[model samples]
Target: MNTMTLWHISGWGFAALAFAALLVGFSKTAVSGANTVSLAIFAAVLPARASTGVLLPVLIAGDVLAVLTYRRHAHWPTLWRLFPAVAAGVVVGTLFLVWADDGVVRTSIGAILLLMAGVTLWRRRRAESADGADEPDAVTSRAGRMKARSYGVLGGFTTMVANAGGPVMSMYLLSAGFRKLGFLGTSAFFFLIVNVSKVPFSAGLGLIDGRSLLLDAALAVFVVPGALFGKWAVNRINQRLFEQLVIAATVVGGVQLLLR
Candidate 1:
């Protein structure tokens, strides 16, 4: 396609992408799993591989907004513990992209997300049964070095492959007993660093280019409103409801990806 043709998008396509971008901001600032909707929309609207590139800048913009809103509540110890393993996972995901087709990428990420959602739900159930209640401590143990590393690796790989890190990290944070603000704050920072790091790798792989950048610029404008809406929602939503919603979204998103 010509440059103009490549850049040109239909009204509905633009609207879909704009909504996806808004979801990015909302997910960053409030309900983390809502981003699965954004990812699915991007992949539907663009090539699977190319959509990740287009979404990255928009994610970073949301991350920046989230950081500004919840920077004070982040827990650095967990982030520090996860960094090395997360980096390794990113490398592995990068290597996978070298030979993997779009179908493989979609199905692989889908399966992973489904499995993770199952695990998170199962664990939560087990804890509730054991304690007769779903207390934070019962649901999630303290983040030890090993646990952090394992989740880190998974988070890195998923995020790198499909921008699906939010679910992985959300499960981890919930398990670790982080309340809403702390969870959002930590997630905001983690994604900012990771997404920025991926930029060079994506550009090198030709996933990012002038065309994608132009689209991202348009999408970025909607993120602010979404972020603002998220901030408002976060204050009112109950913890249990939030977690349940996230898990449901993750499962649905994974299924969509697999079938796509």
Candidate 2:
């Protein structure tokens, strides 16, 4: 047997990739706030641009599973506001990919993740004290539409750039009073469409090709079980605790990205 493999693929690299794939699948499909960990792990192992490209296909695979699992529970209005802004953000991110330097990319992604983490943590703390229970806030009234839009715009930009948008969008949905199924379903649809939309863009940029695609295929398999686990965990977890866990994961992920 060969002791070494191409790119050290059999060593820590594959192990890292596997772990990242597991997290990506889980975060994309269900637990929303686990994105920060996925981002850090993938970036650590792969080139930054390549990491996004390789991970997008795996994310789409997970999104497919999420859609299947949560199709009936989606809140259409939440998606309506979020998708358009997110699409616009993707356009902006594509432009950045075309022109920005590495420093710009790093700073932008780190900042966005940090901001999302901050918001998630702050809201969770307030919700804990104010409600004495973890309920989606009463932010969905007509009065809350403006607030939601504001959140949507930021979430779109962050997600488009780094796939770091989950925690951002998750906080919005939670604050807007979406409960478990509604939040999961809305996220499923949102990411499913967005990740699919990124295919041609990533290709055009040459971020994904033969090797990346093959790697994606292997990683996609993990997403199925990760997502299923997320769905099952959702059933047993307290709504408040679940939300808090996501937020905590988000904070950790965001900080790691920033520090890295």
Candidate 3:
């Protein structure tokens, strides 16, 4: 498909894509896991396999904005420890993509999203039950390293397959006791690096092409306003309410994908 062919989407379809792109920016800055909704939207609108490629550039755009917004707060030690495991996961995800058909990919991503949502909910409840006790530092402990590796591999795989790494990383950071700025900062840099690295793999898979790039070009502009809005609202928004909304959206998106 050429550029013009890609423009053959209906007005409603384009609207949905634009909204999803906006959510990508919002998720990057304000809420890390919320873009799972955007993932669902893209997959529903475009071919399941191809949506991953098209959404990657948009995610990177948001990552850039996020890093710029929260660059100073990142903890480099954590990022370094996770990279090796993440690389292995990325390789595995690429291989899986090579063999999986559209139906399989769609169902797998849907299942993954729902599972992540459930995990997040469980973790949150557990933390609350523990009365938010101060846990050991995840950056320094041996156990922390083990946990990082586990989350790292999963994060890399989910991201490569479905652009759903945000939730996995969010859970890890929360478990590590990262405050808001630190979490956003580390996540921003992490995704910028990972998503950029996925470009060649996505292209090799025939998921990134002229047609997808054309659509991306049109959709990326919407991300800017969404990002700016998120930046402005981040400090003022009620954290509990915002988190609940994000999880609810994820659940809805997951159900849609599974039922579609």
Candidate 4:
């Protein structure tokens, strides 16, 4: 209960961590806001700085699993195109992390998430109206390019500060017209590369350390089951509905991050 005790570890807290990991798994595979919930939970259980470090490895673990599950489904062209801009955004976010107030950071992240969620919802709605039980032209292009530069930049900035990169990328893929597995797979790989790349940056920021890594090692156990379950759930659910779930969760999580 004391601050010192929290700093070490909490057994029931691991349970809390596992529950959050389950959310992370779901978010990684189904929704984009899972990180927001996991981030808040980890921050509550550990120090904010410590929590970010601790959660990063576990996320990478989940990212690996998701990438494996959906590896073949990624839209590589979109991913490749987004890389430079995303990297640029990451630098911007890392810089922002250096001096911004936590409240300001959360609010900005929340606002972006909320806005992306809204856009995704509207697009999906239109996609459904345009056609159903069949893939639309919008979601099926290989060289589809419009907002790649803009989305990539925003996605990078969001992910860096609040680990909010998932939704940013989610909206990008959604607008580009990727299917569920493709979206999940592309997101999986993109974050894998991006999140892994962040280790050094995060380290420089002192957002990662020994205690946090140990905790990540311990909590990584929960993500597999969550991913498996999400995989199954997505298979049976209607694609539109499944994405709506993710978008709705995004709005809630986004708002929470901003309001918190």
Candidate 5:
């Protein structure tokens, strides 16, 4: 591969990537489902397929920070229940990647982002309507099992395809009545394991290589500060306002990709 392929990014493009990398860390530590914006920015700045590869390592870095901060709060049983279905979905997603070209992937990612945003808004409205009637854990009952399996597979596929699985998993956790700390903790561990697992598949697909890794190295520095800032702000931040911002940014990014 020509070195220029990696280094061809302009200073402004690099700045954008650096900002996206920071958001990756911030999303991991503070807002569980906010990184869809990062995903959109990355895809816009780089080739769609290559963007996923370059973003994976940075996500892992953020995941590590999140896990360290919230490791104790993770719900193990939920993770166990979801893993098999998620693995199956990952395999299907790999097959899809084998078939898709860059343009198709880009369009698919844009669609997925928009769909996830819609789902999140719907879930939130439902949650508000239900109020105090928090549903029981979705990993125990037969209906819950089916629900987990459905979400697990969808989460796996979305994450594998576009690094857009956060919203799916967030919906699952919220529906299952995860408190804030538990949600963050479970999400932190789930993504760390899943994103790390994706490395070999991405490598096999040639999405990750020397050039992508080189770009990752350069962008990674920004993740640490972002994570630290998120950690500092997580408790103080206004949840409603932040979520609104996340949703708005996601819509814009999704529209841009679809139109592009």
Candidate 6:
């Protein structure tokens, strides 16, 4: 499709896409897993393959805001440890996309998101039960190099295929005992780097185009307000509430994708 084609979307379609864009920004800064809603919305509004392209620029815009807001809090060592594995996973995902049609891609992503959401909830429950009512604000790092790499690979694969990396990374960060700021900061940096990395791959696959760029430009305006709101909200929220919201959004978004 050409640039003019995207401009023909109805007012309601634009409204939904704009809302999804807002969610993208909010998720980046406040609730990390919440962007899964944006992913599902984009898919619903556009073709599955085309939606990924349209959403990439918006995600990167959110990532930029997240980095600017949380750059100082990032943990570089952990990010460094995960990079190699993430690269491998991205390559594998790109190869998979080569043969997979939209139906295959959509169904596979839905199933994976559902499974990951279940795992995240299960882990959270176990952690809460084990730690008791007075759980520490910070979790001790249980992520060895192997485990980190595993999460990294899954994160890369999911992000590449469906922009569903947030939940995967959220689980990993939570497991490693990252609290609110640390989780946001580290995630902000990780996605900034990784999402930018996907640009060439996306272009090579013809996933991004002038039409998507036109839509993205319109959607980008809402990101700033959403991000500011998220920045404000994140500071006031307690840890348990934050985790619960993220898990709920992930599960709900996963189910939406499955049913779609």
Best by TM-score: 5
Better of 3 and 4 by lDDT: 3
Candidate 2 TM-score over all chains jointly = 0.83
- Candidate 3 C-alpha error for residue 204, in Å: 0.5
Candidate 5 root-mean-square deviation in Å: 1.8
Clashes of each: 1, 0, 0, 2, 0, 0
Estimate, for each residue in 1-260, the C-alpha lDDT of model 6 and write its tens digit: 45245335778988999999998898898878777778877777776766777888999999999999999888887788778889888998899888888777777666776776787777678657653321123223554777877988988988899888887888777767676688889899999999999999988888888767877898999999999989998878674776676667666766776677
> What is the C-alpha local distance difference test score of candidate 1?
0.79
Residue pairs whose backbone atoms clash in candidate 3? none
Weakest lDDT window of 10 consecutive positions for candidate 1 = 131-140
lDDT of 4 by residue, 160-189 (tens): 776767756765666656666777777889
Could you give candidate 3's per-residue lDDT for residues 221-259 as a string of tens digits? 999998998999899878677778777877887788888
- Deviation (Å) of 220 in candidate 3: 0.9
In model 2, the runs with Cα more than 4 Å from the true position are 1-10, 129-145, 238-260
lDDT of 6 at 144: 74
Which lDDT tens digits does candidate 5 get at residues 1-260? 33237446889999999999999889999988788999999999888877888889999999999999999989999999999999998999999999998889999999999999998898788667764322237467999899999999999999999999999999988888887788889999999999999999998988888877878998889999999999999999997888888899999999999988
Candidate 2, backbone clash total? 0
- Model 5 scores what on Cα lDDT? 0.89
lDDT for residue 50 in candidate 5, whole number 0-100: 77
For all predicted structures, in order, the TM-scores are 0.85, 0.83, 0.93, 0.80, 0.95, 0.87
Instruction: Write candidate 1's Cα lDDT for 1-260 as tens digits.
Output: 22234345679988999999998888888877678778877776776777778889999999999999999988877777778988998898888877787788778767866876786677567545552312233313454666888988988998888888877787777777676677788888998999999898777767788877887898999999999999998878674676687678678877988898
**Which candidate's lDDT is highest?**
5
Candidate 4: 10-residue stretch with minimal lDDT:
131-140
* lDDT score, candidate 1, position 129: 52
Ranking by TM-score: 5, 3, 6, 1, 2, 4
How far off is residue 106 in model 5, in Å?
0.5
**TM-score attained by model 6:** 0.87
